[model samples]
Target: MGVGVLDQTGATFAEYLPGMRAVIIADENTWAAAGAGVQESLRAAGIDSDEPVVFPGQPVLFADDAMVLRVRDILAATGAAAVSVGSGSINDVVKNASDMVGRPYLSVCTAASVDGYTAEGAAITVRGVKSTVTCRAPIAVVAPIDVMAAAPSRLTATGLGDLFEKIPAGADWLVSDALGIEAVDWDVWDLVQGPLQDAIADPDGLRRGDLEAVEALSEGLQMSGLAIQVHGTSRPASGAGHHFSHQWEMEGYGRDWAIPLSHGFKVGLGTLAMCALYEIVIGIDLSSIDVESRLVAWPTPAQDRARVEALQPAPIIRESAVRASAEKYLPPDAARERLERIRRVWPELRFRLAQQLMPASEVEDILRRVGAIHHPSQIGVSLEQLRTKYFQAQTIRARYTILDTLEEAGVLTDVVDRLFAPGGYWYGRSPEPRWTDAS
Candidate 1:
């Protein structure tokens, strides 16, 4: 399936649609931006198409069950194939809805905002928790450079942030491989790594809305999505940073009475945080840790539940967190066993992790140059929240990340504390700097 990144996106869509009727799925904003033109293109191609299915929303459209049902109903009633004409949310909703109706769909991307456009999974809210629902990849992806470049700079920057996540994401995969959780797939890794590095090497053009930069960013994100498709897992493009983003979304932190930051932006901030943690892990002296003492201090299940309750996440999130905590809450004997394994392989693991992650400072500088938000505070998360939830993020997913390694070693708290201390990555910038000192 060819991903068309051309000026003639409408023409490309016409070629794909052929004689089939298409239902243009888009939100109001997307309809204004590119949906109308896509409809006209179908008309010009002599293909029957119904009036566009314009979702009612302002600023953003969410990929929730209701929206998915609405689109599926429209497609079923009209007996038309779907042609999603928007970015992340619209594309995700259509992807899931089309799968429900067992119909192939095409994606007309309007912004370089996320990798979901071409991925096999839809990032949707299920039962009030942000989750990835398995779905079919679009039959074809059409990203017009002009449309992408015209997107708000924040959207493009968010796209850059999403691609930048691969740095820490790759490192996390290395960690998982070291721990025998999941081995890396070099084929899938190669799909996004080279393009990701080249896309962000110099983001000045992206900031200025240059077409080349827009194409590069759009292509990079699309490739990332394809990477996920090839691997049959999100590991190639998601890791610790993505877990942080999912946690914030589940808790409704950034979305409370405010426009939520894009997924890329949230993950970008998360990427920085994860990188900082990686630095700490690399510098740790394994011989110095008193494994017995740390193991004895490990929190019991009761204590873990109490701490999770104190955070007061949504009921569903709290339930999930409490359940997941069991996996990480190891007894002294179990902890000692894990600690011994970690100690035996600490040097090799440290070297692999260090080799995989870019310096936190370097990642931050690139994001800043591209106008991406690098701090969690930029998206309304407080230091207290970060401190409380950083570890929780690890529990929310069964995946093993650098966070899991730190937690198992009983240094996660120390690492978070130092990350928020003065001269640290998040120092003086979080909503509550005083919390850092107390921790």
Candidate 2:
């Protein structure tokens, strides 16, 4: 129900869920790192704990069906309350599995890696498509500063990437509100924006693994989870950036690369892309927009499906993309109506969006300071790949974002091309030449 940020390990768990038998869930590495200590602490608090369920691998755990069932089976057999002892994947798996068993669980965060720890939904992959499955939040969150600060620096950097996304995520929310799609809840906005700014204010310390900085990052992430819980949606914490990440994950896009990106790492790159796109959106003169001409140029479903398939993503991803496109693609009249609304509110919308987002350069600087991957190249994604297919990410989600805005305005292609042009944010960073034309 609430999070407990603490300096001491193991002891805090007792205070939250005293005298209950628990089954600690962790991966091999986490069990060695903190799971064992957590078990010892539970004993000291007069709580009985079954032997920790340790999954094999140093590879990041995917919150998929197999993993969830495995954890659920253990909890069912043991009949003990669950205690997740790692970050992100572990927490999601345990949270969902605990919900399935109708048992309350506590989380002992091992890293400041993601904002899902205290959220009411678990991001899991079901049959190759990534989705946020509704689940109960942990009854209590036990985040020990020392454990989080000492976590692998990459994990912390990943957390920073996730935190940085709040800027563009909030901007997307503002845009959706302006379009009369989804209203922005200022209370939820207030919950995440301030903490995100505070975390970025001392990026150097966070990079160096300072306890205070790590704790701040952890608290901010926890608050983000709480904001989602309050809104009953991920709107406050996710947006176009997350959609991009989900697409990549569904396709196994970066798995074979030298450096596979984590969920937050991919989102960070998507965040940068969204911020750059927002810059373009702000400068557009809606008065010159010709909605009728654009509608005539819109691709048919077959043509769009061919474009998505050309990218050679997984079959499931391609199917999902086309399906979403069908739902999101607008007719000329609908497009004109949406464009008129945008035009009417351009002044207020521009001001609010600008206020909600940090400049892309500032976000990139913070990512660099925290040693996070800010470019697609770092994760082995070609510029052409992103330019050609990134818009499909928007189609895969019903959630409206800046991508949908551009699509509705019939300028997504032009904006994407500009993002790769000379002097653009991604220019000269790609290993290959830019696309010759917007096409």
Candidate 3:
């Protein structure tokens, strides 16, 4: 299906009938940014809302009881047949809330920061923990390329992160299918794969603020939404990476942390870390490890947090990475062979990944460009914070991705060392990869 566009022309909301009765919900930031245009558009479309609900700040927390109560009151008063949300958070709120009321709603996306815009479930914080609750996908998703291109660079970066997540996530899904731990949806995969590739290949299109890139991103996100709808769960779009993010949210550290990264940003980092872990693992052999030696003594979150805080620049992250590797059940040669086999099957794997995968190097560059924090130092997030998130991430999600695989096999510590090694693939504070040397 072709995309649905509703430019800021102030006529988009007219697509719905005036008599149809609807409530418009938007957060303060979004409301101020585009409120006039949206209201004008609705008015032009012959749709008039007696009440428009606008909340302060962004709707980052889905389980805010006050917001829920307010929305419920709005719905009750409007007796509206539907809702039209003007932001991602607003969309999730309206969508999930509408689901509760058996009402349908449409959304006009304001930022590309999240994939939830088109997904069938809302990621909400319930009782101070991030939780994914199933909701109906919007009946329509509207976006104008002009509006999207003008969004902050970080929002675009977040969108890129969301798109990048599909790789590790898809791999985990495939592995689950192989192990019979979860069911895979080939159709869902089929739908998203093309748009995903298209988006990755043309990331320059995004950096250049190309309208086509915006369109592709929008399309890819929507495809992800449909995939969730098809699977009746987020398994198709989220995996270990998401778990890591969720775990961080649940641990309460991320909540109280000095600087909080977006869900996509945290998940993106996890994806990169997990992919690196997987590569290290698949490069080895599996049967050689002594089972007893491979078990994680399973440190407490507090201990893990302390270890993370104690991380000294590059050595610390690498130590944890290497530690993770040492415990992996798979031997280095076998793990390497698996990667080689995947390469044999899809010769373009690395090339394709090079586009979407935001390594620490890429993240560093972007962070510098946008003046955003890229280092643990920049955010004042000590190694303890990282440890807390990492450990918690393993606990929240059920997927057997790289972290789980390593923890299960007992090579987690070794992998941590390699991952955080100075000059390693993760970026910054590095002794450098031993094989490559300065000229």
Q: lDDT of all the models against the reference?
A: 0.79, 0.78, 0.58
For residues 1-439, write the lDDT of model 2, one tens digit per residue.
1123332335566666666677888888777667767877777667777877888745667778788998888888888888888988889999999999998898988888899998998978787666778889998888877778888787888888887888888888888898898998988888998788787678788878898888889889999999999999999998888877887877776554433467878888788888887888887865456766866776776776676566546677767777766676665577778877877877888887877777788878877678777666666677888776557676677788988777767778888888789977778864533211110
- TM-score for candidate 1, please give it: 0.89
TM-score of each: 0.89, 0.90, 0.74
Name the top TM-score candidate. 2
| Model 1 residue 155 CA deviation in Å | 0.8
What clash pairs does model 1 have?
none
lDDT of each residue in 56-134, candidate 3, tens digit only: 6633434443555567667866777444545455676777777777766767777666778777877666655455677
- Superior by TM-score: candidate 1 or candidate 3: 1
* lDDT for 241 (candidate 2): 80
Q: Which is the winner by TM-score between candidate 1 and candidate 2?
A: 2
lDDT ranking of the models: 1, 2, 3
Error of 3 at 258 (Å): 9.5
Clashing pairs in 2: 1-139
